[model samples]
Target: MNDSPGWASPGPAPSDGRPPENSGGSGPAGGAPESTPSGAKWSKEQPPAGQWSAPGTSGQRSHAQTPRPQGWNGAPQGGGWGAPGPGGWGGPPPAAKPGVIPLRPLGLGDILDGSVSTARAHWRTVLGVTVVVAVLVQIADIVLQRFVLPAPMEITADPESNPTEALRQSLESMQDSMISLVPSLLISTVGTLFTTALLTIVVSRSVLGRSVSLGDAWREAKPRLPHLLGLTLLLSVGAMAILTVAALPGLLLGSVGGALLSAFGVLAASVLVIWLWVRFSLASPALMLERQSIGQSLRRSAKLVQGSWWRVFGIQLVTALLTFLVSMIIVMLFSTIALFTDGSGMGELLTGNSPEFGWAFLVISSIGAVIAACITYPISAGVSVLLYIDQRIRREALDLDLARAAGLPGYGTEQPADHTPGS
Candidate 1:
């Protein structure tokens, strides 16, 4: 199977044994002609900060340092400093710093940087995809909240009524709230699937050090939509079933074992659900990138996640926390400003006790939701794809393949059988 689906294709072998340029890809800056002075060789290694090195000279480094490259700012440049060819001045490859990520076995920092870099490097494509999805989802949510759902009913504690009646009323109210949330949940679910599919392709292309347009990403993702949707549904059903089974002990034994059994069951289910979620999180990337069936992708995720569960979990946790933090900051800022400007009862709105739904409130909150989604989606999707790539690198020596795919010259040999973690 090809390592990169939709992006990597085999062709006539290069005459000089150099790795062929990426199929359907332009050089670093979206297909610009990349060249260097002929006869000069560039190093395969990146020099330390503030230092440059002449190629083919071990331990011979230059003291001269150029300012950080332009692409570092996340701006799209036509071409960056190109590597010198044979007998030309040896320098960094033109695609060396294409986008945000370097093609290699990634560290945590690399994953994080790659995530942010992708958004910055291809802001137009990445943001465009996310903004359109988010705005549509938000519009759907706003419509559901403002028009379809019945107006919120104020429920007060009925001290004069029987306790049993009051409990029943509270339960009914809770059920109503849950029912009203269903449309929003469905909207979010669909939005996540579409965005993840598209962005996964974008992130994958970035890993290959190639730039892709929104159209390219959508075209690559479209055929996989059904598979991606099925995979998501499978996971969702599986999680719900596991939790239900876990809760069965509590439900059946409720009176016999009291609340202790219920508490234990809930706790155990939560732990198992989290573990499984983290473990299978890479399944989506595998399904989309490897073009595997649902079963194959789940098994592939398990295989890759087997020994690296904690590492993957930790990285995912950090990404979630970071995403949440940024989102929280953005939402809070917007909400605070809106609360002051609109003067719609902040207390009631925040506490979810408002008896009335204000159009202004819905619009403001939806705007925040849209902004947060736009920022968080790429980071979340980028981390997953990068994690999948990292695992392949660790277990399958995928870095060599990625290097060659990115058109790095020296790594064109077949991946070694004796793959070491640090290799």
Candidate 2:
């Protein structure tokens, strides 16, 4: 191999199992003759070999000999031909880094750092999309909580005096909780869908060291929104179905034994749901970047995750935990402040009453929610996109394609065309 970075070429392989002709051998003469094909050739008009000093030596060359031209035979001045330069002979070239990450298989740190770097580099676009989606979603949630959803049922039941009435009140409270939860869940899901789609584009461009705008991301992501929504709904329904099936038998039996069995079933079902969720976690990026059908994207994700399930799951879990912690901190701080500012909320807490939050409390808490969403959305989306890219780099040698796409030289001869994301 040549001793140059990014320009090394493989030597010719022997046609048969034997070594090539003229290669050095343990012969009486110590090797092949000077005329052999593999032997180094010397110029006819060469200076005396001993006259020039060896590279890196302090000894001076004979002044009688003529000075060689600067950068003779591609070597820097004062260096022997083919001598080692700053990088020693045959060292691997540094990976190309056009954007947030180097085009290579990524480690956990690389994945996390890349996500943050992408968001930081493209804060205008990244924050813009996330903030808008977060604000809209929070507004909808606040409106639903304050006006559309029913008020919290008063739990005035005294089980000692009226057991039946207490049971009925408990059921009503559960019903109200579900009613409130469903709308919030739906709103959050919609918000995630849009942010995921838009931020995926931003992250993709950032990987290629390119800047993108909110308009550009929307234009690129608009076509894939419906498919993404379908994917989200499909995953949600599948999980719900699993849980329902697990608990149905217990509910129908209405006995202690059946309830025990149902609990076990639900536990097992939860494990299965988690496994499947991680297995298909990369589907969103695959769908958006590859422009693939929902089925194909799921399959692609499964294939990428097949052997590295634990690694992918661990990375995703860590990301989720970090985001959750950050959001919790922000929400808790604001909620605490809100409690002090809203007299009714403070009174309800003090009296151990169900808090009927007023508009002041709701608006303050919503602001916290908006801020949390803005921070978490970009991070979550960035990690997902980067995980997908990391998996592809490991499995498909995607770094080469990424390097080419970034217009890095020495990767390929042909120029990259305008292809789909990840193509």
Candidate 3:
């Protein structure tokens, strides 16, 4: 039977082991007694194999009569499989693309493009969700920085004259920085959690060429939010615990050599953290899509990433770098404008003093941050979801399921064992 688009016909059934009834027989009863036709004689000289022309052909073989070059499957070759030809069967038909990406194992470009295309195609839902989340996060961060967080501690000790005092002040400054960073990190994490959950759903729908509304995304994502939060917190706490443990011995020693040892230990632990992060990176999507428990999702991600660690690492790393650059550019642009608008702030910064940012600078900078988050959130989420889908397609043949989910023609149809349909 001829194969249908997006479907391959089943092969013929296995043959029985028995030989044919008339095997090795020249005549009816396995005896050689057939008479030759009158005046027909075998020729002494024969043309080499594949060189002789059929009867009624001219001495010179016509182009139409010449045997067409055979393809790997013995079909007369035109442009080869999947290449455009007279009947469009020069090669296998193009992969069924029911959505942003073709239903097949994806390349890096395909994954990135699909992510952007999903955002572009479903901008209303994607941008709407990201914008709201980003705006809220930025506003909270601005408020925290402006009112809640302590001002930068002033350093008055002279380093040369009072080295101990200066060192104490420096440590206090570092402590203040970390203290201020905690709230911002928490706010950003919460925002990312919501956005990643909602956008995963949107991107998944877009992969099937289906449009989703913000409400639909929220509804679908809400059920999975708790598990997602647990996963996020688990990872965050795990990383912190590793770092803390790495630095604990050095902290106990409390000496310069101990400090160096702690730093080295932390650095080594960081490498381990990065490896673990990549190994379980797909857990979010797996949890959201498969409705797996956090533990199950982690295991699933590890299983999928088992043999493709570098690839997953490279894609995630590139995505993170690109998004960081884009966000920086946007933030810098707005920051420049804010500085120009707030002359005092710019003056303070230029004078090698900490800038006391007023409402104008804060608002403008926050606006820039909001915009950056809006642009990057969808892209980051899209890549994560698409990467998960791509991995599944590669390892689990997910394209067939995606095609079926998309309701594409000729996919996911089953035939009865005893009844084979003609092509």
Per-residue CA lDDT of model 2 for 226-334, tens digit only, reads 9999999999999999998998998677555666777899999999999999999999998888778899889878878988999999999999999999999999999
What are the lDDT figures for the candidates, one per model?
Answer: 0.71, 0.74, 0.74
Residue-wise C-alpha lDDT for candidate 1, range 1-423, written one tens digit per residue: 244545332222233244333322322223233346895543333322332222344455332231122223232222443445587765543323433565445779999989989898788999999999999999988877777888656567788877556655775687678778877888899999999999999998887667889998888999999999998888888887987677677666435353357568778888999999988999999888877789878877887798789999999999999999999998988777667656556666777765353667667877898899989999999999989877765555344456556544333333446887787
Worst 10 residues of 1 by lDDT: 62-71
Worst 10 residues of 2 by lDDT: 1-10
Query: Ten consecutive residues with minimal summed lDDT in candidate 3?
Result: 1-10
Cα lDDT tens digits, model 3, 1-423, are 112111121121112233222122321111233345875533322212332222323655332232211211233224333345574434333465778998767888998999899889999998899889988998899888878887767766574755445545666677778887999999999999999999998888888788889998888889889999999999999999999999889867765666677889999999999999999999999888877889978887887788899999999999999999999999999999999999898899999887887888888988999899988888899899999888866655456456556665333233446876793
What candidate 2 gets wrong by more than 4 Å, as runs, is 1-91, 156-158, 161-172, 413-423
Mind sharing the TM-score for model 2? 0.75
TM-score on alpha carbons, each prediction: 0.71, 0.75, 0.76
Which one is best on TM-score?
3
Residue 236 displacement (Å), model 3: 0.6
lDDT-best of 1 and 3 = 3
* CA displacement after TM-score superposition, residue 354 of candidate 3 (Å): 2.2
Which stretches of model 1 miss by more than 4 angstroms?
1-99, 152-155, 158-173, 248-260, 344-355, 413-423
